[model samples]
Target chain A: TQLLEQSPQFLSIQEGENLTVYCNSSSVFSSLQWYRQEPGEGPVLLVTVVTGGEVKKLKRLTFQFGDARKDSSLHITAAQPGDTGLYLCAGGPHKTGANSKLTFGKGITLSVRP
Target chain B: EAGVAQSPRYKIIEKRQSVAFWCNPISGHATLYWYQQILGQGPKLLIQFQNNGVVDDSQLPKDRFSAERLKGVDSTLKIQPAKLEDSAVYLCASNRLRDARSEYFGPGTRLTVL
Candidate 1:
């Protein structure tokens, strides 16, 4: 079973639209991270939330870590074609030390059409 | 600063053949990771190394897979008698020791087993 589950495996929206993607898990985590990946490339980190109930904003992107620390959400306001890519959420377990391993969701593929 | 580098961005091999992928992490990074990403799924950690020593490799299939990070700078992953299911994108990522939040990744090597 996948430790992390992502909703809306695929999403296509016109430019200027707003959208949200979710990542959920039954197990609690110490930190959750969001990443974006483009075609023919590796994923790049977008944000990291360490405290529950924390919310972070990156330009047009807003990321929230659930109060329970078991879920996360990414909301894009006025999405643009450049936002087209795969969104991935990864969770770091609490038990592991500082160099903890990460568990990743299957990911959400977002296609923003111009 | 140069990003993580990977060789042979694409590889094609027949089942039962052997293949290898190489990775060179960014300078000063002490932690390295190898991940396998099947189609439509997030990258799965196969092995992790810290300064040339194996840190975590629980998910690696020892029967047909092996990896090495000699000298603690660059790493290589090898698969012997490759299977169809092993066809996937192999990604390499690295971070400063004990800093799991700043991972940088390579473009990855896409492998196809015929």
Candidate 2:
């Protein structure tokens, strides 16, 4: 079974529209991170939330960690064509090391049309 | 201030052949990671390294896959007797030993096993 589940798998929205993607898990995590990947490129870090119930904003993107630390969400305000990419959520185990492994979700593909 | 570097952005080989990909993480970063990303899926951790010592490699397919991070800076991942199912993008990422929240990634090497 996947440690993390993301939905919807694919989404297409017009520019200026708003959308939210979710990542859920049955396991609690020490931290959660969001990444955005474009075609032919590796994923780039968008934000990291370590505290439960923490919310972080990066420009037009907002990320929230669930109170129980088992889920997270990414909300985009005023999506743009440049935001078209694969959105991935990765959860770090509750281990006590900087080298703890991260488990990733299947990812959500976002297509922002101009 | 350079990001992680990966070589031979693309590779194609027949099944049962061998292939290798290389990566150089950001300078001063002591933690390195290798991930495999299949089409339509998020990247999965294959191995992680702290300095020249391996911190975690539980998910690596030992019978067919092997990786080494020499001098704790550059790393190489190899697949022997590659199979068609091994076709995917191999990504390299790294971060500071003190900061696990900001991992930087390289432009992955896309491998196609025919």
Q: Give TM-scores for every candidate, taking all chains together and pairing residue i with residue i.
A: 0.97, 0.96
Estimate, for each residue in B1-114, the C-alpha lDDT of model 2 and write its tens digit.
Answer: 899999889999999999999999999999999999999999988998989988889899999999998788899999998999999999999988644776789999999999
Which candidate wins on TM-score?
1
Candidate 2 local Cα displacement, residue A50, angstroms? 1.1
In lDDT terms, which candidate is top? 1
Q: Give the distance in Å from residue B93's predicted Cα in candidate 2 to where it truly belongs.
A: 0.6
If you assessed candidate 2 against the hidden native complex, which CAPRI class would it receive? medium
What stretches of model 1 exceed 4 Å from their correct place? A96-99
User: Clash pairs of candidate 2?
Assistant: none
DockQ of each: 0.76, 0.70
